[model samples]
Target: MEALIPTPADCEVRSVIKIFNAQSIVPIEIHRQLCRVYGPNVMSKQMVCRWCRQFSAGRQSVHDEKRNGQPSIITDDLVELVREHIMENHRVTIAELSSHVPQISCSLLHEIVMEHLLFRKLCARWVPKQLTPEHKTNAGIVFLHDNARPHTAQRTASLLQEFSWEVFNHPPYSPDLAPSDFHLFLHLKKFLSGERQHFENDREAEMVVTQWFQSQAADFYDTGIQKLVPRYDKCLNFGWDYVEK
Candidate 1:
């Protein structure tokens, strides 16, 4: 038989209180002992004192008493409503959702969006917990390239036009304004530095780079892309001169 590893119980704090109270230790001393073992965050001082009082009053059970009021109800309809709101506006905040669905509490609405719907806030938008292959393929591509011979070639322009991609004009000799130069390469360079050895071939190098890109959170690309607006503004402010960092 495999050995069973003991996991910390949900009522561990209360159990500790019960044990120490039986030993006639004061609440403050009990709290100090708990802090020494479990750190201060395990339970607050006020909670320790409250539990100590409960034990003194002949309360044998460490389990919480059943309350009289109604529990917070989370319906399927409420979950659907939250989903609709999010789909309508991906950048909708929890507070905005609350205004749309005033019946549910903000906390409950958040639970519906995150736990039930499996969506997380990324780049100021509620995105899926995992990006599907379809999601990646469907994402809009905003192409930006410098005025190199190959990039500025007629064939390249024709290909971009065929794909219907919106190309941002890259000012000549302004690598500072390029997101790949200023942001992406800086991080990519650091990542390459930590490699164990040089890649065997171009294929291996491409695989490694693709894996690194996929491993990054959805917000990573968004952050790099969003920097362009501010960078352009700064570049214009500086009269098209090299925009200092």
Candidate 2:
């Protein structure tokens, strides 16, 4: 059975152990469950016990800790090489970059790009900055929000009037027309879920969310806002009924 079945990575096995351990499953039971699916050679009982103990002690990451004597893949020359590739084509993907620099893993490459070089993906393209100048100015910016209590409050109305900003009328309970509800929140939820992020405090969560927003390209926001036109048309044509996607 072990010969026919392909082996899973150590990290993969660790992830399974972590999940089961979180549910208070004993190490022996976890190993038994894993053996049933991945064959007996999946992991040793002792290994499962060790990981369960680690998680119980508050270890969050599944990846192995960096061990001494392992040579670092990231070097000045490699950093320069990555920089050259990004400079040549800002749209280059991690997969494409890996083909050019096959010596390093994609995860390591991502670390180099994000942490070492301070580059991030914006609208599917790697960029150094958000590159949205329109945000720097409030000129011709139309503010649109729902008629929530706080939003429709006298203070809010006075603030908008004070700024001389054009406030677009939004009907009640019209989430379809709200860019945040229909678009931003959807992507935000996916990003949060995919990362399985656990924040220690509100500050950490806020920092992560702010970084996410800053990483987005101008076109990402523009695209979301642009959809409001068609959405508005739909709402009006449907006699202001709930616009279901």
Candidate 3:
């Protein structure tokens, strides 16, 4: 008797388990290029080629997507938009972003945020002087959060307070908790592909994103909260050095 043969997901996860067991990031361009150039035929030692074949050929149980781009579609404004939506509405998705940005395909919005944006593939953090740790700690923590800042600057603090009741921030390199990493964006990939649908314009995209966000778990904020505690801890323990790449 032989061991039960697993599905494509089993195989893919196994392969990734092997590589990521060691833990590494493969540039998607290199992976996609190998499969695109050599794919329609033949085989090789390239693990990426194998991965591309398994995924693109429908051999894998996981959804197969063919992505090709040396650069990303995300800009500072797009990040700002995603951050704004998540901060205000409690969820953000490709459909929502279509209004903010219409040039991309729905799949791109879904996958691109994970492959590119969340990983800082094209964008970098723009830490404002006001958002720093020192500024944060100086503000009497709770007062800094709700009571203190509003007393100092009622208007500015009020606007911020509206967003904070729902917003949760994750630490750098903590991909597992970020909405783009954990569920929202990935769910969009399954949705757009499974439904064979794509939004044609910004208005349509906004409707889609808004609808998708509404479908998420009420406790969805917990994901970021759990991850952020460690991040905040690391910040306290190491300050600047503890939490950086």
**In candidate 3, which residue pairs get closer than 3 Å at backbone N, Cα or C atoms, i.e. clash?**
20-23, 95-205, 95-209, 96-209, 143-148
Residue 82 of model 2 has an lDDT of: 84
Model 1 per-residue lDDT tens digits across residues 36-69 = 7766555555557667777888998876555468
Q: What local lDDT score does residue 40 receive in model 2, on the 0 to 100 scale?
A: 77
lDDT per residue for candidate 2 within 24-83, as digits (tens), equals: 999999988888878977766655776787899899988756647976767544665786
Regions of candidate 1 where Cα sits further than 4 Å from its true position: 1-141
| Candidate 3 positional error at 1, Å | 84
Q: What is each predicted model's overall lDDT from 0 to 1?
A: 0.73, 0.77, 0.44
Q: Per-residue lDDT for 63-114 in model 3, tens only? A: 2334477555554334444544433333455577677667767776655555
The prediction achieving the highest lDDT against the true structure is 2
Tell me the TM-score of each prediction against the true structure: 0.41, 0.43, 0.25
Off by over 4 Å in 2: 1-139
* Candidate 3 structure lDDT: 0.44
Give candidate 2's TM-score.
Answer: 0.43
RMSD of 3: 21.9
